[model samples]
Target: MTLDEDDRQRRLPAGRKAQLAAYVAETGQVTVSALAERFGVSIDTIRRDLDQLSADGVLVRTYGGAVSQSTLSRVDRAVDVRLKMEEREKEKIAVLAASLVEDGSIVMINGGTTTLAVARNLRNHRDLTVVTNSLLVPPALSPSAVRDVYVFGGAVRTLTLATIGPVSFRASGGSELDISCDLALIGVGAVSTAAGYTTSNLAEAAMMREMISRAARVAILADSSKFGRRLFAQVSELGGADYLVTDSTPPPDLLEALAENEVELITPDTREGAPEADQDPQ
Candidate 1:
């Protein structure tokens, strides 16, 4: 029997409420500004929502934000949250980035939402040696029959849930990588023609910088939202990367800026029948 449309609209499932509770508890803090922006709701609506969430003990209200009261799992807090945000753009970038990997290659992948999508697409490739500091990548690639996943060890940053420290940097640097996959797929919080790639944390920037230096080829995976944006710390110059994979067709001015720095720009085709540029020549 079909339920009344208004009744269905007014009712939310218990599981969804629980999931929202869990999300608030894991994120550490959620500000009204962030909520309003993320959900496209008014600040007053977000405040009221936070008030209800706070009363449930999932979050504690602060002056302008709410703090999580429970510990968050790395997978739940970082990987899942990221996948839900900017999902379509990341998926397009991921499919494009994965097309770069061939069989029997050793590739380094940096930690981020976009890179995680790349890892998911790499599962079918045979005899791949995947090295990554992201806690999320291993599980996604683990079940693949042809790939070997290596999880780098270091202090895990709670925000990104990726390992970073002197140890991780040194280990990544010490490896002698093959030219076949001397390619590193990296992620950044923001990218600007002026500031290059930036991250919210300094240690993450250092780790990414090390990866960039060690790899023979560097490809950056970022969405259009990252364009012209700046974060807290600069990781590398825009010229440092060999290729930039993005979902949007960049503006002419921005395209000229990237081309001037010799950065090759690639955008993926959304339609099934559309042709992709061949990476390897026949």
Candidate 2:
């Protein structure tokens, strides 16, 4: 079993409840009986735990069990840990997002596993100028002969492996602050129609605000699972971004919200003979 599975199977009652929340976050929803069986607890006990979690707004109570809440709790994972979670989806998202970049254009990428995948895919575009605060991103584009990679300076966040703090604003001054990038790629921790875009880390959120203001256009790169969730820190509202590139078709409500906010939803075609850069949802 994976470590998370193991954690779910053999945790103490209190720890088990916490694990349950994470599981719901991963799967979106779960039934009471399934949660009880997985956690080796009585149905009554599971119900009580769910009630507590729901009251705390960590989950939403349903008929038989619960689903994840729209807002994510203040939980974080390491960069290496997240890099292992959505490898295939991230890569596909990277390919489609990279196609948005043209030659001889400046691009700003924030720090996140999904954005890191974007950097990797853009390595062949030697003529693109890349600016980022992610330590992991600069090296990814090092091999490209036509690329110019700039790593912003600040206090490095060990967990995310990105730089943040007051120094980040200083390092990205002058021309860098002129909102000159052709594209700004961001990663969303939680996003919804009501809550808009959010991240778990406040420092990262602050830095992302600056990146958004200085970019010519903003595009959010997130997987389907990240939808309908809100994190502790608000990056911007729905209208903050110009595009959302993803692998899945968002729900109808979210699609309407995006349209109302004037944000284009970009879903790559998973079929044969589709143009790569701007294919509609399949």
Best by TM-score: 2
TM for candidate 2 is 0.67
lDDT of 1 by residue, 1-282 (tens): 244543343234443344445656667767779766755457886677777876665666666766665533222344544554567888788878877777887788888889987877765577888888888888767365345666767889876778886423233768744422468999888888789889878888888888888788899988998788788899889899998899986767678888999998878643344333323321
Over the stretch 1-282, how does candidate 2's per-residue lDDT look in tens digits? 798777665567777877888988888768899998988779999999998987786877766867675322326865644664556777778887887787788998999999988877765466887888899887776365345777778889998999995323333444333235778999888789999999988989998988888788899988888889889999999999998888888898998999999998877653323234322221
In order, what lDDT does every prediction score? Answer: 0.72, 0.79
Question: What lDDT score is found at residue 211 in candidate 2?
Answer: 84
Mark the regions of model 1 whose C-alpha exceeds 4 Å error after superposition: 1-79, 145-147, 167-181, 269-282
lDDT of 2: 0.79
Error of 1 at 126 (Å): 0.9
Error of 2 at 107 (Å): 0.5
TM-score of each: 0.66, 0.67
Query: Which number leads on lDDT?
Result: 2
The residue pairs that clash in candidate 1, if any, are none
